[model samples]
Target: MLDLPPDLPRLRTLRTWHEQCLREIDRAIAAAEEQARAEQQAQERRAAATPPPWMVGLQDITGTPEELHQGGCTMWAHRRRKTVTRDQARELLAAGIRACEFCKPDAELGFL
Candidate 1:
């Protein structure tokens, strides 16, 4: 770094520009945080809605395809879910869609 002259007036202007850049960065960060919160609220609303009766269980990489859980089953919280109509549920079960033992969706569908 080069030594500046003692009477250099550029120092004040540079400091002002730096502060303006910092303020803009802070505003952008706040906007991003607000957007994230809004998205989270929307997701929560979707989760609160009543789930369909027949659900398909989500499969994870390298894991077996587990049985589908009932809509109101507590185990649904830990897995991803897909909603299915009553008839579709029956068809799925008939086609070898396994039912969760805890929720026993097959029994709920009169299959068991």
Candidate 2:
């Protein structure tokens, strides 16, 4: 006749160890997943708080409206009267130089 299982104690011990290992692995995976979620949330919060263009303390106020367009209209129609050529304005704006508050570079459509 064929021999049956020798001892059930060894089988129970093996099962217990296997179950313990599986539980530990599950805990580790859960912890990793939680950490990943936290990291992703933090990144999202940072992205939302930060500006789109990674600029410092300014909105993307690029270009101006067309209300001041005329043949003989004066340029730089803000509190301050600083005027620059279209090329110069483009260069300055491209260099991340914000418009002068008084002059209101963003309020000029001639350069646009």
Candidate 3:
């Protein structure tokens, strides 16, 4: 067991010091949390500013022509993909880029 100091002044001083340390620690944690929140908001804004294109075409490993798909197609989960504009998608389709069987980009583009 720890022995308590008989002098009240010393005990009061120690309590005050402990409280101040705790307050400082709390302030530091709050500042770190605020910084994290600001960073996440900035990232969200950047993502919103440059939204993904409406259409995308998955390319082969060699970056050669491959299947065309919509932006949210499931086939692209494991495939390499690149975003393309609507006109570019049409051109790629014309260039024999096969439409994704799942998303059916051809029907969405009124090509079907």
Candidate 4:
């Protein structure tokens, strides 16, 4: 609750006050939007700066590693994937797990 001044009895004065309030509200909205944009940009930067996992192990229905893919590979549509470390990826590739043709993790890890 705000204590409005009783002296603003004139229609012109009230209209002026209303315009000022609208301007203030617009300024506040603009400031909030700017802050939101800044925050979203910061979030995007953080996501971009964060590196993807080095490798991803594509698993079969049995939950066994079936293929190796580079971290950024999107060719495989199956959701049965697990993040793998460099060494793990190498071991899997060396164990004869087929590397994804789209994102050759084996070649990336010198397993080609």
Clashes of 3: 0
TM-score-sorted candidate list, best first: 4, 3, 1, 2
What lDDT tens digits, residue by residue, belong to model 1 across residues 1-112? 9665466588777778889999999999999999999999999998888676667776766444456777888886877667778887888788887888898988888998
Error of 2 at 62 (Å): 24
lDDT of 2 by residue, 54-106 (tens): 11122225343222112122333332223345555555566656544444544
Best TM-score goes to which candidate? 4
For residue 112, what is the lDDT in candidate 1? 84
- What lDDT is reached at residue 59 by model 4? 61
Q: Which stretches of candidate 4 lie over 4 Å from their true place?
A: 1-26, 41-51
Q: List the residue pairs that clash in candidate 4.
A: none
Clashes of each: 0, 0, 0, 0
What TM-score does candidate 2 get on C-alpha atoms? 0.45
Residue 54 C-alpha lDDT in model 2: 16
Candidate 1 ranges with C-alpha deviation above 4 Å = 1-48, 62-65
Clashing residue pairs in candidate 3 are none
lDDT of each: 0.79, 0.51, 0.79, 0.78
TM-score of each: 0.50, 0.45, 0.54, 0.58
